[model samples]
Target: MAELRRENQKTTSELKETQKRLRQLTQTIRELEEENSILRAQALKLKEDTANRDLSFSRELQQMKEQLQEKSCHVSLSSYTHATVPTPTLSPAAKPPTPPDPGNSPIPQPSPTSPTLTPRDSPSDTHSLPAAQPLNTEPNPDRPAKPEAQVVLLMDSNGKYLDTKRLFPGLITRAKRCQNRGQAMELLRQDTLGNPQHIVVHTGTNDLHTLHRETAEAMTKMAKRASREFPDSRVVISTLLPRTDTPPHVIHEINMEISRSCAALPNIHLAHHTNIGTWDLHDGLHLNKVGVRAFAKTLKDVTLDRNPNSLAHTAAPPRNYRPPRYQQERQSNTASHLPAAPRPPAACYTLPSCPTQPQKTPPPSPMDDLRLCDEQSHPSPTH
Candidate 1:
C-alpha cells in the first residue's frame, strides 16, 4: 500500500510538472500570437501609409496636368489672337490691285501659275476666305487624308471575295492571291499603318480549319489595335466564310459575338460576306469567279457609297423640284410697277425677301424719344 501510494504521489508530481510546463507553453504561445498581431498591425499601418503616399502623388500629378492644360489653352488663345489680327490686311496687301476696266466682265480670271495653298489649308479649302480662321478647338485624331487614298485591305487566302483596290482607285491591298489567316493577321499587325483612311480586315476562315481557341480574342485584338492605332481610319471587319470543318451554328455564334464586339468599337463596320457561291472544296478556300465579281461589285458599291471622296457622296437632288415661275414673274412685275429702290447682289438676294430694302425707322416711340432726349441730355462721360 505504501509502495502504491509513493508510486501515485510520484505520478501526481510528474502530472503537476507537466501541467506547469503546459502552462508555460500556453504563455509562450500567447506571447507569440500577440507578437504576430503586433507585426500584422505594423504591416497594415505600413500599407496604409504607402497607399496614402501614392494617393497624394496621384493627386499632385492630376493637379499638375490641370495646370499644364490651362497654360496650354492660354498659350493657344494668345497665338490664335496674334495669328488672326493681321490676316485681313495681309491678304489685300499681297493681292496687288490692278483695277479692272469698268466695261470688263465681272467673272474672275484665274492667275497663270497655280498658287501654293497655305500649310494649314487643304486643296478643298482653296476657295475659303484668306483671313486666318480659328483652328479646330478639338483635336483631329486622323489627318484629312482622302478616303480612297487611305483605304487598305488585309485579306487571308479566302479574301478572293473581292478585288477592292481595282474598283476603288488608290485603295491598298497587302494580301497575295492566297495566304493563311494566322499568318495574315501577324503580318497585318506588323505592317506599318502609314496613316490609312480605311482598314478592311478579312480573316478567320482558316481559324475554322485550325479550331484555335484564341481566334475570337485574336480578332478582337486586331480590330481594337487598328482602331486605336489608326483613329482616322475606318475599320471594316468581314464575317468568316462557310467552312465544312466547323459547324454552321458554331460559326454563326462566334461571328455574332465577334460582330457585337466589333460593333461596340468606334468607327468599326461589320460587313457580311456570306455569299453562298463564294467557297469551294477543290480550291481549298477560294471564291469562284462569279462570287469574286459579285463580291467585288458589292464591296465597291458599299465602300464607294461610304467614301467621303466619291462623287456619289452627296445624294442626287430631289427630282421633283420645279421653279416657282408664276410667283417670280408676279414679283418682278410688281417691283417694275413700283419705283425701284436698289438691287442687292444676286448671290446674297433670296426669293420673296429683298435684302436691299431700307429698314425705315419708326416715326417715333414715346419711350424711345424720351430715352433719346435723356441720352442727349446725359451723354456717357468719356475719359
Candidate 2:
C-alpha cells in the first residue's frame, strides 16, 4: 500500500508539470497571435500609404502636363500674332493717288527686274509721308475661315460611314484611316491634331484575332497615349465591334479592360458599340450598311457631345424584317408536319353571314315533257 501511494503521488506530480507546460504553451500562442495581428495592421497601413502616394503622384503629373500644354499654346499664339502683324514701311510718293482714267492715263506698273523696297532698304524714304492707309484691317473675303468645331476621327475603314457634307456646318472632320492599332498609332504620330474638341479612336477589331490580353493592353496603351497628347480634348475610345469569327467573351474582356482604363482618365470617354451584333457585320469583319449607319451615328453623338443612348435606338433591327432563308425553310417544314384542322360541319353554313354552297339537281327528260303535252292536248276523260 505504501508503494502504491508513492507511485500515485509521483504520477500526480508529473501530471501537474504537464498542465503547467500546457499553460505556458497557450500563453506563447496568444502572444504570437497578437504579434500577427499587429503585423497585419501595419501591412494594411503600408498599403494605404502606398495608394495615397500613387494618387498624389498621378495628380502632380497631370498638373505638370497641363502647365506644359498651356505654355506651348501661349508660345504658338505669340508666334502666330507676330507672323500676322504687318510691319511699317515708307514709300517715295507723298501725294494721294488719283483715280485711274482709262482714256488718257496709263497705270505705271512696277518693273519685275527692280528689287522691291522696304522701310529698311532706304533710310531716306523713312522721312516721306506715310501711306493714306497704313494698315487695312478689313477681313479678306477670299481667306478660308477657320473651322469652329474640329473633330479628329482616328479609326479604321469604318470611318467611311461619316459623310463630311452631312455633318454640322463649320465643323471640320479630319479622319485618318488605319488598318490596325499599330498603324493607328503611327498615323497619330505623323498627323498633327490641332486643338480639336474631340479625338475619336476606333480600332482593335482587327487585332482581336491575336492574343486578346495583348490586344487589350495595346488598345489601352493607345488610348492613354492619345489622351496624353491631347490633354484638353475629350479622348473617345470605341469598343470592339462583335465579330462572328471571335468569341463574344473575348471581345467582352477586351472592352472591359478598355473601359477600366478609360474610367481612370477624366477626359477619356467610351463609345460603346456593344449593341452591334454579329448580324451587323457584312463579311464577319467589316460593318454592313446598317451597322455603318449606327456606327456613324454613335461617332457623331460623341463628337457633338450628344446623348449616348441614340446608338441603341439606331442599331436596333427592323421589326418587320424577314427571317433568314434557312429559318424560313425550317419553319415551312415544321408547318407541313403539323396536322390540319378539322373542317366545320354544314350546319355552320346555315348562318346568314356564312355563304351556302350550291346544290346540284338532275336535268328534266324529253319523254316526260312530251307526256305532259299529250295530257294537256287530250283533255278528254276529265275524271
Candidate 3:
C-alpha cells in the first residue's frame, strides 16, 4: 500500500510540469503576432510616401512645359510684325518748303512822319527798314521736320538667279542681276552712290558644289572691301541653310568654314539659325514654313538689335559700349585731385633703360664685315 502511494505522487508532479510548458508557448506566439502586425503597418506607410513624391514631381514638370510654350508664343507675335513690315520709302518730292519773306508789302506802311515810324538821328537808323506788312499765304520754315537717316540694303540670295523684283516684290526698289563675283562687285560699287548703310550678303548656295578654298577667300575679301568702303555699314554673313536632298555632312562642312571665316573679321557678323536646333531641315537645305518663320524672326531680332539708327531711336547705349576703368579713374582724379594708389612692385627684376649708352661697334668679323671695312679704307674700282 505505501509503494502505490509514492508512484501516484510522481505522476502528479509530471502533469503539473507539462501544463506550465504549454502556457509559456502560448504567450510567445501572441507576442510574435503583435510584432508582425506593426511591420505590415510600416510597410504600407512607406509605399504611400513614395507614390505621393512621384505625383508631385510629375506636376512640376508639366508646369515648366506650359511656361515655356507661353514664352515661345509671345516671341512669335513680335517676330511676325517685324518680318511683314516694309522699310519706309523716301520720295524726291519730299523737299522742305521755302519760308515766306517778312518784308513783303501787303498792308500799308505807317507814314515816315509818325512818331512810331520816324527813325532816330543815330547810326542805327541808317539800316532801318520800312514797317512790315502782312505776309501772303506761304509755307512756314519753323515747322518740325523729319530727320533723314541712311537706307540699308538687305539682299536675300535664295540660291537662285531670280531677279530681286520677283523675290522681294515691293520691298526692294532697285534690283539687278549679276552672274559672277566681278559683276556683284560692280553692282556694289555702283550702289555706293546711294550711300547704303548696311549690306546683307546671302550667297554660297549656287557655289556649293563648285566651292573651293578660294571661293571662301574671295567672298571674305569682298566683304572686307565692302566694310572698308562703307565704314558706316554693317555686313552680315549668314550661314548656308541645310539642303533636304543633299547630305547633311556636306552642308555642315560648308557652314563650318563660313563660320570660321566670319569669326576672323571684325565688321562681319555670323547669323546662324541652327545653333539651337529649333527647326527641322525638311528638304535638307530649304526651310519649311516653320523654319522660314524662325529664320526670319532671328534675322529681325539681330538686325534691330545691332542697327545704330534703331538704338538711337530707343536712346539706349550701344551693346558694345564699355568705358575703360582707367578713364573713370582719370575723371574722378581730375575732379577730386585724388591720385590712385600705386601698384605693387613686380616680383621679377626689369632691365633699366640705357638710352645714353653709345652703341659699341664690335671689331670686324673674319668675313663680310672685315672685307667691307678694308674696302672702305682702301679705294677700289669706281665701277
TM for candidate 1 is 0.37
Candidate 3 yields a Cα-based lDDT of 0.56
Which tens-of-lDDT digit does each residue in 1-383 have in candidate 3?
A: 78888888888888788788878888888888888899888989988999999999899989999999998887676455333323444356654346455578576566777656334655554443334445323334554554322334334444333333433343433433444455456556634435544455555555556654455665666667666666665666556665533444666676776667667666677666553131244434455555555455445445444442323232232355443444456677797876767776774456776689788998667898878889899988787
Give candidate 2 regions above 4 Å deviation.
1-149, 189-191, 308-383
Put down candidate 1 lDDT per residue, 29-127, tens digits, no spaces: 999999999999999999999999999999999999999999999989866644423243345546545657756858666566967567576664444
lDDT of each: 0.65, 0.76, 0.56
> How does model 1 fare in lDDT?
0.65
Minimal lDDT window, size 10, model 3: 308-317
Estimate TM-scores for all models. Answer: 0.37, 0.44, 0.33
Give the Cα error of residue 269 in candidate 1, in Å.
Answer: 0.8
Model 2, range 1-383, lDDT digits (tens) per residue?
Answer: 99999999999999999999999999999999999999999999999999999999999999999999999998777555444345655545545456577666676655789787676797765455454443444455665766644777787877777676575456677777887898878755424666788788888888866656688789888887887777888788888887766766778887888887768877888888756766787776788888887777776677678886644353455666454455567779988999877898999878577767999887879998998999898877756
Candidate 2: worst 10 consecutive residues by lDDT?
129-138
